[model samples]
Target: MAQWIRGWGQRGWAAPAGVCLCLFLLLTACGQSAPTGEKCLNCHEGIEEISAAHPMESFACVTCHGGNPQATEAEAAHAGMRGGRNPSDLAVLDAACNCHNGLAETGQDHIHRVRTSLQTTYAGAIAQVAFAFGAQPDPTARYGMLAVTDDNITTATGQPALELFRPGPDDSPMLHRFADNCLFCHVGGEPLAQPYFYRSTGCAACHMVYDNDGLYKGGDPTIDPAEPGHAREHRFTTAIPFTQCNHCHNRGNYSLAQMEFLPRPDLPDDRPLTDLERRELEYYQPIAQFTLCEWKLDCIDCHTNGEVMGDGDIHSSKLEVQYNQCQTCHGTPDALPLLTTIDSVDHPAIRSANLNPNYEVRVGDTVIATTRGETFGWVLWDGQRLWLTKKVDGMVYEVPLALGTACQQKPDEQASQYCHECHAYQRTVAPLP
Candidate 1:
């Protein structure tokens, strides 16, 4: 005790005291040992589905979100919180995402990818508009040729590079319209109107799901409410459902399936839709007659993280992104490898599939190790039966793929086109009663 006092005295009393105070604040901020039992945790303890990487004991609420961890009162505790409820906002990304600095192999380094993504920047919109006005050579040309350094004014293309693309001043009217109306859905733009659609730009766009009715109760946190609603759960999970993706994918004019241009005279607002009307609104032309897997499975079931989040490469269009075809899973006509034996497993593909927890191995099974030495034991199939699992909810399904039955498609010759040939509603008929 005497030696400790002497050490402090040598370093100057005030400086030593300040150091001790900083250390105490850091410990408290991380929720190591809070005198009042971690005020944030007191309210949020009910939400047990936080990411496995971020445990409550080691990573406190205040560490990523700036707030007064010492404050006992609600208002005071949330006073200086950055990005409000969304930590994935670019403003707070540096502080919140420092942990992912070295996790490129696991695809945790998503901050840089989102910043440069065509979906976030609307680079495709810019390129198309520029090409329409003869400013660029091709509509399919890359955004890099335009030389867009910031949010506004591309330097190399679109009439006068220095000024804003507006009607009165600029030569390109189409480019001006794109800049005015079409540019707001990107990363830094305003939040969506629906509370359930409240996803932050960059990382949170895909990972988080804000249940407004259950969590916010009355209003969204991104928009100020008359009376602030209690946030029920911070649902951050890799197992994203198709409904969560419907807001952007289904409601937009530019859909991946080109369904926006299709004729839909059935939907007249102000009345609840009938079953047929709902079906028409939901599915596109050929997609309406797709197999059960198309309707039952989540988007992430087929499209892995590297395809969606990106492989640290800037793509001009969604088509350019890497994805799995039907052949990748079901196999070619000549060969169909059943994932029963350890030697038969497609190790690289299986390792890639296991990136998300939804496709992870079941709790207790024979662990199949990848070539990179990561082990996974969840068996999706044996030699005889296919043990398929749904990604949205952990529901296991076993189906027989034998020949000379109602299912005419042979297991050995299963392809996407082959499955669609017989499984489509138009081709299928009811069994004789």
Candidate 2:
């Protein structure tokens, strides 16, 4: 009988619980027996059963959620399945929300204080100091800037020639041309060089924002609180704050020196400031000579005059209001105008004057000229005088009528002597023949 049972176990037949052969024999006789791993799954489909249960859906019974379908002894089966624990015991699991969600309620204070740190996962790439061109080091703040051209008329003569944008279509009430904002100086085409030391022209790309609350009236600002991460306040100051400005301005990721590693014509000739130097520095430090040394005020302080100044106590027009700000100290003690001009004088025998040949000329106007680097057109000769004025668009004009004769002819010193002999005439007859 034992040999027959061994043959049965060796074949595909199910194995009885071998601990007590007598009990197995009696159970088999009573038509009750145990099934092995393969025999039970043949009818039950254990894989499908295990998958239907959500708690154990992630693993098979043998993987972790342990059980012994093949065993008959209760104690041995429980020990094998649960490492000596009862097989029917329920396991405690960790909370899903705790591991994968937003910050906890207790951590809210720390999160809100650092607005930059509170940036959501989707706030675009992290911003570096150099990355944000024209971005202020302080928390979101701003100022406006302007450039204007006006028709500076002479009250003495009602001359209509005082036009800012002349030789063009006259469209507006005033004769003037103007542009404002950082682009005026930062952009190309103007004679002024672009500032590499300062912010780039692409400031609007990242900084552009809109306020959904269109003009809030009588609302408590503290209760509404500028709608987190938005710029609602209109006023800003150049006065640097202690930790406020240093958060983004001092050494580290947002250091000014790091942003200005490249060659910049606008930067001062000094390297990184020492601790002593930084301590000595003023809050709204004045720029040096090439960068307007005396002007402690910034661009917006002078430009945003009527809108923000005196209206809401906004200090926008501090510079414009005090036009005497600069002149008050620099001008004459008697309050005379800071600037003075010299009027035109008349001199007839002036030789080297009226050199453009426009004022004084003769019938046979043969003028000998020497070649300079890129010299062009005829030099003005009054027959008796050799005239000189800066050339613009291939034409040169004498700035003052009398003193055109004395300007030094650099490359040609002999130009003065040569004109005295060959070309000489009276101022009354110069004309285009």
Candidate 3:
């Protein structure tokens, strides 16, 4: 026994049950893990680059859409994909903002301004509805769909913060109905499943255009034709047309008393509308009075980026930020419109113009500016006449400046409603059945 002990040592106890189980699981997972042999394009055939600027040759889809790009099958590959086939949705906006940092110093925060914009937050609408329904004491904006904050204050009307609104037990009954119906119109909110209401949420709601049909009309053969919620193409555009805006606005009227949305009775469902017919309907309501130029210019041509999108602040109402007026182009009958020169390559207007395909803003160009110094990049002053290049079609119009014209408008009192008293167009609408 003494000689055997000297020759060999005794063995220790076996591993614990947990350790043994972990080892087995590790080996099994290694064997059963998803295959990484194929790439995203192997299955998603016929898919083109998102746009001319974002060619797939350089920019990878995985960069914006988080997905298992190495996976061979659908579920595993699309498991973490942002916005579920929509990379630009607010749900996945953090990833989308990464691509928008190349414009300028302020450009890095472009998405922040949009996130806080009245369109996304719908703070003004919420405030109005809340006040009308007695959910709040006054019409001041106190809440939004999601809570948002602005660290930087740019304007006097910008709200520093907004609280997330939810229906409480003590809330008025009408708020419930409003919460159900009215919330669908915001930029990030999912549009109702209706013909004219079909649009992607967030930035895609505009940039990624959708036709009335809401079906895939792109070159991607893999996309299902039966699906009814895809963009018209896998592309982005800044030269947005009035039709794009029509998908959200001018679709219908909402009754606060009834708490219901009534589709436009004038809108014919059976057939498409002619260009003039569509323009007449889209300009405003049937009873609305507006000038001819209101229809001639697309919504984006007049509404500045800060006006349409938020300017890093939450507003109480759309009118609070809607400063664009008739005299922005037409003079005050006393002086020429506000003029400024583009002198820097890195100007915000240059970056803004570059996003679109229609026109360019170059150095030494004299363009009109707002009273507050924001440049109107499209309008050019040649010291004689102002020429405006249309964002939608690139057609130039010789803007008649009121240097010597008989326009007796008080320069400060030149809002659209005021001008309508003089130049309100009377066009015939399609007769109702």
Q: Per-residue lDDT for 1-433 in model 1, tens only?
A: 0011111112121122333454464455434542344577554445553554454665667766778877777798889887886676766776766555334554345665555555565555656667767666876535532232233222222221112223345546555555555554566555555443354555666666544332443222333333223233454676676655653554445332321222222222434766444443444333345666555556766565555654444545555554355544444344432333344223433433343454443222333232223332332555544444555555554433333245545555544667777665442322122
Cα error of candidate 2 at position 58, Å: 49
Q: Can you write out model 2's per-residue Cα lDDT over 1-433, one digit (the tens) per residue?
A: 0011111112121212231343343344334333335222332332223111112332234333245655455444444554222111111001111111123232212111111110111011111211244233432212222112113221221121111112124422111112111112211111112211111111111111112231212223332343332222221122112222211122122124332212222222244665333333322222212112112222221221221111111121223122322211111223221221111212111111222222222223323221211111122344443222221112222212212334333323232233333223222211123
Worst 10 residues of 1 by lDDT: 1-10
Instruction: Name the better of 1 and 3 by lDDT.
Output: 3
Candidate 1 segments exceeding 4 Å error: 1-38, 41-49, 72-76, 139-171, 195-198, 211-232, 254-289, 337-359, 362-379, 398-433
Error of 1 at 432 (Å): 32
Tens digits of lDDT, candidate 3, 173-253: 888888887788888888877666688887788888887778888778778877887778888888788878888887887
The residue ranges of model 2 lying beyond 4 angstroms of the native Cα positions read 1-263, 266-270, 274-325, 328-331, 336-433
| Clash count of each predicted structure | 1, 14, 1
After the best TM-score superposition of candidate 3, give how far the Cα of residue 239 lies from its true spot, in angstroms. 1.0
Q: Candidate order by TM-score, highest to lowest?
A: 3, 1, 2
Q: List the global CA lDDT of all models.
A: 0.48, 0.23, 0.73
